[model samples]
Target chain A: MGHGGGGALSAELVENVFLPAFGGRTLAALGDSAALSLGGARLAFSTDSFVVRPLFFPGGCIGDLAVNGTVNDLAMSGARAAYLSCAFILEEGVETSVVGRIAGALGDAARAAGVEVVTGDTKVVESGRGDGVYVNTAGIGLIPPGVDIRPQRARPGDVVLLSGEIGLHGVAVMSMRQGLEFGVEIESDCAALGGLVDAMLAVTPDLHVLRDPTRGGLAAALNEIAAAAGAGVVVDERAVPVPPQVASACAVLGLDPMYVANEGKLVAFVPREHADGVLAAMRAHPLGAAAAVIGACVPDHPGMVVARTAFGGTRVVDLPLGEQLPRIC
Target chain B: MGHGGGGALSAELVENVFLPAFGGRTLAALGDSAALSLGGARLAFSTDSFVVRPLFFPGGCIGDLAVNGTVNDLAMSGARAAYLSCAFILEEGVETSVVGRIAGALGDAARAAGVEVVTGDTKVVESGRGDGVYVNTAGIGLIPPGVDIRPQRARPGDVVLLSGEIGLHGVAVMSMRQGLEFGVEIESDCAALGGLVDAMLAVTPDLHVLRDPTRGGLAAALNEIAAAAGAGVVVDERAVPVPPQVASACAVLGLDPMYVANEGKLVAFVPREHADGVLAAMRAHPLGAAAAVIGACVPDHPGMVVARTAFGGTRVVDLPLGEQLPRIC
Candidate 1:
């Protein structure tokens, strides 16, 4: 099964296998993060595992990704990520110095994100049984009052906003693996998005949807939101930002930038009325300095996404079967 | 690296490598579970990953181990586990039927323990990059008011109660590998301990310490508590429960039951005054039906453990340098 692509196959796996066995109202919501009310306090929880190859990428390693990924997942639910549990599966012969460096990166990332690594576990496997390392992080976040953000909240006329340029993370990781330089270096956009989400929520509590363009990139995320909300999205290709270096890298590698992963970028759907305010708020944040509105949801063509090219042609942007770039996160 | 042993090597890795990088006040406690206060609610958080081989053993599989292990960790903190996040790293070539069965077992275990698998993640590694499956479960449990349990709380005169027989889980796993059986079949004692803890907590809220003798069995757990509290432990070898079947299996394999693994047993430290009540409460639960006062905390020989044999002889019970039976959980 092509489960890692975050496409139809992945959705089916969750719906048929996971949900049927672990189904509940909270999990059934299928949001980026699961929201729970515990002892009168609203909380959001999420987990993600990073199996990126070449432990050290251009701008980030598995450590920062493990921290920032879960933080971003919680942030997408309008929650303040507070604490994380990091569990590492290390191969037996990995160097202690390497482990120390990764842990240092993880601590730095957690500190920068304003979250604590309060609990952790470490297990080592036989040398041949595992890669150098695999990190799984589970996070807990506090959801603010009167704020609701979920994919199902998207409606017709909701404006879609992109936080910044895409494809940097995928390109950066791939560049390292291929040992090729495209004249200019492409550093991963790997980062924590909680502060950026906080800025957007400051504009209004009415934001409809928040999603990070991760495993399957913006296309999968948009398609998922559209499918969940029973809405359709129409994006103008020219409005979507892509750095020239990353664009050239993708071109050389025969990859679609639209479907390539991004660690820090997020796509939000805001109600039309508050679109300008939310866009302004997002643009002001350092993480979202290049934020731009690229699309809008429509009632027609429900559960579908289409992008209008600069040449005035429309093409369907469907989810890829499998990850175009495996383990790029 | 001796990471699987949960013994001296594991402790060194944590104290020397992990703690320095990911250190915080809560994490410094080094309890079975880390206690955190969020929104006025005290919660216990912990994580454990299972890489048990064969996927299935006599009485349990990785599924139940993954669920029960994390639940037991939270239970050690005197918390009622509420939710768990399960993450699976599956090898690409593994059969889907195996995955489905594991998920089914996991669901059943969670339901029986009264905990929900609220959020989860699945990532498939290319064939040969992983074993059949490795599961990582992170759990959250809420601690009741008036309950403050930690390893550092053990004190002189605290009675140590062993919940049940030792070494069953380890023998069960090894039995399947060796393809030999004792006169009586041995089954893994893998199970959730939350209910038993709840029952004991009903008797008194000040139970000093709770620990599951899992990887390095009672020796490692007791050594940890002793070292943490700056106290010593003295146990009667005759009083420690060891089922005949497990005892025979350990004898034939040249293993000591005390140093073998147990999944569903716990050792608790209770003030002498409340020892009888806590013992009665533990015996009332099926999981703790064999509960007995096996040891006591003593001021002499601080940070050490000694066992008085039935023949009027005493021997030091030191923590194993590495796991005698690896991946027994």
Candidate 2:
């Protein structure tokens, strides 16, 4: 019933269940956001629900996560997010002040992202029936002319640029859970990436693909794009940025940094000719200051991802059946 | 933290928290759905989340409720809903078959309403962290030209028409929860109202207002419109149709039929001159087969709803603080 680990099961659910049930052309594409033409205007629509436990966490809370997550999904489709609808389900007996604080956070986040919360609904469940509060945000964005981005648009020579370090969000959330710490306080990299994406699009609107490694982390995101584009991808493991603290946390916790989730990061596949310009533009943005060219699309093996280890050996980075950390986002 | 009972508390929360946090032009209108111009196209967007205790009920499940609820909200804006986004938060250890059944119901509901489910998201929570399933659906629709409908459009001379018999949906879920029968087995009136709305719009595009009576009953719906329009409303108590089974069930349960929710019913305020044509069109549709003009907007007692009893006395139909039966929808 619940297999959204961003692995084989998640794909199976979409292929065998959701697609067949919804039965629409755009839905079959399985992009992060659905792009469609309505009344002669191209628009992107997307939705996500935040159920992360302990509503407040290091660096951010579920409120901002809900806003940024959907915003990033819209950005992945090269859309300028304009409006958002926030619906919340709250459990009885929760504090009104808590809700007020979260709403403030959400408002701040939406303003920063340049989107307005235009419509919303609120429902309440009995105490113990829900975990504090869960937020669902659905957004609408306009796709600019001459901008076309999708996973299947990746080509053989496309460069894969990662926005920043991996595993910070997951590690941050885990550190606060059960009173465990890694000697250093790590904060979640949760922020709206629409501005960063707009910067990149300003450089070149013809970027092939863009994705946020959220649920299944960089590994799951890369695998999904490779499978969708029917192309092989190779990443230099050492080039992939993992902050020293995050690396040590993963090492002590027996977790793979590649499969740990990120909230404000994105991986873009740009044409080789425009890669340098795009990389430079990304570096100029605060969110992408650590942006690195971690990998590239290849034609050797289709529908797979391979990582070249520092030990001079290559290994397959398969999508995990389920995420090592659940509800990290 | 939870005050969404469609009553005074709900209104206060909206006034205090939501309006302040998401302050904007359309949101200030407090319509069922927000109408905005996006890329030179007029669009209606609305959202609702289903947190009904039982995932499945008599006539519909949470899936259909999630679909039809948002669809009806868009319909209230005089829009033809085009696309919908479904997001699910499922509890771990739930049965896959249950999710499948609900998805099938949602798909069927969307198809019947002539809308497509274009984008979706799924997230899972650990056991004991969430209810069995909660579904949130947000929809986009196109509003036709010159068809402006809003709650504040109700005038003193407008006629109020109700779609059908009330209190069935609330009773259906209540009966299932308490394992009690109403002797006649009341099924829920859960359904999409887009087609029925289209039928009325076909007669006249300038209908004053349309609102589906969900979460709140006919009384709450009328009170809200009255308060928003700052006009008094008078209802012929004998003319408001309540099925015998529902009346008896409410009697047995010590509930007020007027405050019981109805999912498939709508109350419309139309100009007196066009009331006959709109009523004729509403009756022609199966969903509104029992449509009747039970009330009229009045200039006396502004912002209050008066129910004229059979004996010549009148009673104020004030909004309740919260629903009598929680999670009925």
Candidate 3:
């Protein structure tokens, strides 16, 4: 289970097992999506399999997550998703009604995202061999001209901006799984980010890097960008937004908000000169109303991410060795 | 399990559950792959999930099947696969060596087919929640200009061609699973068909329809084409090739050779004028060495397939309700 935790174990699996076996320059980049040129069109291709334990959650279901997850991956590359291919693995004896509900959610989500579910496949396993349903979605999107966003593009002096409050998605799923009630109901931030990405791109196509803080969360995304660009990231912890309910829930659960996943959010590394313009654009978008300038790429301590505490002490924000929460996405 | 059998159940799932939910013309076509235009380029996209038991089979394992399945789907649309995305759902304790082996085979298969695995994802489930491994591969391919092929394009005068012998893949996996002994070992016809598709396209790009006789085998492929084209198909059973060993195994197993799965074979519907040239081209290709003109589309009894038996009687070949051999692919 740790292998899928989207932390050090996941990274190691990709680097040691998959990378060596499937040797290619495009895959070696290890970005949120692979950037490719096919028939004179710049395309971003991405794949993600969703296996969240519960079929339904506080704010959304696995179907929407399956659609939004791949959409967000493409959006991270500054691409507008054009089409998606969905494949479902269902365990025998699973109710057709359950499958119907999921299919409806998936369709609604794709339409909301303005992408088409063009091709798909379905397979069934013996009843005990699968967890009701598992969906894998692979998406194709077209990257606009002059847009080259990747982790490697982050450089010193780049400003890092975060789209919204963290920990809602993680807290929402965890609370439901554990059946823990809070004073306020927490909802998963599951959403498609294509429109928000387009708005950001409109400000300037020169955005350096974009990442959705999924799986391993904001900490992992920041650490990855820093490592890939060989730069240091310095974050002001106070500037990071955390919902009071999520903060209280995390306190009760002994989890760090920085390491919690956010489905509808994105973290961007932009040139300092365009930072204000991009932030303004993000704020104007409904999905990015809570956007904030949280950090900056620094020349010192290359390949590391450090956060300043409220009391002014600095601490390293390390890439998690394994997930604090499993199957949260 | 029947839902994934690629017969009536699978078709119903697509029509009743997926089609209504997805509500798209591209998916409604119900071909082996979906054809679309992106940035002025005609593209084919397809997805398949492989969950065959035992991991290793007589001729090939799940690895090659995962890669070749999606490639064949694209080829059915007269497209040359360019890129693939691979996602693995692994049980918690699956050996890394086992994953390594599968990965290695997948890479080799991709290279052999001249396609690249550009992006991928890995997810892990608890031990009892999953089989040892399940692989999902989604592919994108380029359809050459002036090339138009689809099941609906099969016309009344079109001649149907079978690429080679059937039942090898189904019998091979079944023998391994059931430990049934045959005098001669039956190896699966697991192979990539992109090159063969390219060869046939070379003769003429206007081939009406090309289908891989996998899952529900040649019978299902023929039935689907006939139904989609709203034409009647007449097949001479004796003209269809079946290896002697495969024939004996199916006879002992009480299975119909036409209903058995084939991984490396294709059935093509061609215009009568170009039939000879297309058949010649298929025969010249290594994958289609035993290509045979097994049938013809006729105007009578539309949406049905009838096979001529040795006893000089024509019998309706019904679409199978469910798979005779599950997970054969």
Candidate 4:
């Protein structure tokens, strides 16, 4: 088989990768479409794909990762996440239990996020044609009244805040893939950012930009924002947080903490005047307990991002020059 | 490289499989997303996948496929087709072109869909751990009150119509995989069904169930409708047209004409009184000149479909016992 099989394989992908990530009451309807009530506002729609390897990793798996990834993307834009559609690709011979666990996790996570997995599809390939399972999730959310946020809105004087530590997700997943287990648990930083987003919105309706560092990590995300907003960004390295385990792993792997992915964290840009209020709201959320003002926009570094080192040295953080942890996300 | 890359292999799959079958504007967009308005609706959607052979096949593919496929999927759903988030699995090696093409295709498809490629991710695989590219698409569609239709609405007195000849799409692509050219050329029926869907909706507000028979052919579609609406469908075999080239190819391959897949074609069920009006409307469209009233819904054999044979013998059509064509879609 190539892909798009409506059988066990397809079932596995959905059960494993998607259902766990996005399963909810609306999703329980199992209808071809998810019926939703937006409470009246334009919908902010988004979709995402997850082709992670080892499909199963420490802390969380692809199922929850996929669900939260899309939900967070929608939330970043200040949208109240709603329904989701999933599609899957399975390499033949993948264990049914693995898929089942993934599905269960995805379902749990989605329910937690209050998002529903409405409709989905699956396809399977012969042993040599595909990976174990690859998932794609498309989500829709309604933007509440007075909440406007986008990368372009990061003004010159806006404050850049980070929700938590970085690289835990990439390192946790990598450790599992490499069969390395730490005596102390180090969970992947996989989590849905919707709650944190909501809290931020509760305090600052005019938040400028919100982004989660995934594939290319914080550096990739911030640089993208810099380019999109046409504004320079400056951060104090001393203020950036990284767990000891994550830092150790990155150092040993010769990887940059800033370039490693983080699933549960978010970086936000808000009016300088509202930064403290927004930080307080973010810190109130468990996912954003480590929230801190990390940087601010500057005119001179348009589309450029620089950081003051822990050694008090300034270094320009250019766009990722090479692939980071290959596909640690 | 995993799927979604837009490199040589991806190109080969497109040229050899998808392009010949689904050539059109949707293909032309080739972006991270497609941009289009649903006229009065404030919604966007599309669907697609990149299940090309040689998984890590040409160019920076797999990753890109995941992006483009989802973007296209949303387009088919008849929405503005806003944003996409991508996931990937990478085999060892699978160079930059692999990543670039996938990234590029995502960029291209998004540009074409008139939507932004907002978020994404990447993952690596152990050698022999995963195949190259296997893309899946999950899209959204905005439904306007006046354009209500679904598979379950086929009334007993309604007529059946097809966007184009059946099986050509499946035949074209299969022909490529088998290396059995039609001499006159048989391309894969890989195409985006958005425009034609739009056209169909424009023609009749009375449109009922609209289905794209990617796998299991037109027969599968009809059977599905029969089951969904709890009605019998009887087709005048003669009226259900097939291209000479397609028929000839099927004959040599020993494949049933009704069991093949179709990428670009759609089967529609409409009220009997409106069948002629809809046929005329479809035939006038470039992609639907072969549109016809192949059958009608009836009260007999509830939940079943019967196709009057060319030899005048009636045959029961069921959802192809298992799957007649695997991965055809």
Best by lDDT: 3
Considering only chain B, report the TM-score of each candidate against the true chain B.
Answer: 0.98, 0.98, 0.99, 0.74
Sort by DockQ, best first: 3, 1, 2, 4
Model 3 segments more than 4 A misplaced = none
Error of 3 at A264 (Å): 0.4
Q: Which candidate is the best by DockQ?
A: 3
TM-score of chain A of 3: 0.99
Q: How well is each residue in B1-329 modelled by candidate 2, as lDDT tens digits?
A: 22877787888877898778767787888888999899999999999988886778888889898889999999998998999999988888888788888888999999999999999988888777678888999999999998999999999999999999999999999988888876788889999999999999998998999999887788888988998899999999999999999989999898999999998999999999999999999999999999999999999999999999979899999888876888875
Sort candidate 3 into its docking category.
Answer: high
lDDT by residue (tens digit), candidate 4, B99-188: 455555555644544544433323445556555544454444454445545556778888888777777756665666577867777655
DockQ, in order, for the candidates? 0.70, 0.69, 0.84, 0.11
lDDT of 3 by residue, B1-329 (tens): 88899999999999999888888999999888999888777899999989988789988999999999999999999889999999999999999999999999999999999999999999989989999999999999999899889999999989999999998999999989989999899999999999999999999998999999898888999999999999999999999998999999999899999999999999999999999998899899999999999999999999999999978999999899987898776
Model 4 over residues A1-329: C-alpha lDDT tens digits?
Answer: 20111222323333454334332443332221233332234666565667666787777888888788888878887886776655666667766566566667777777788876654555656687666777777777777767767777789999999999988888887777777766666788788888888888888799988888776678878887887788999999889998888888877778789878888889999999999999999888898899888889999879999999999899998666545555454
With candidate 3 superimposed using the best TM-score fit, by how many Å does residue A177's alpha carbon deviate from the native? 0.8
DockQ class, candidate 4: incorrect
Q: What is the TM-score of each predicted model, taking all chains together?
A: 0.99, 0.98, 0.99, 0.79
lDDT of 1 by residue, A118-214 (tens): 8888888887788989999999989998989999998999999999999999999998999988888889999999999989988898889999999
- Count residue pairs with overlapping backbones in model 4: 95
Could you tell me which 10 consecutive residues in candidate 3 chain A have the lowest summed lDDT? A320-329
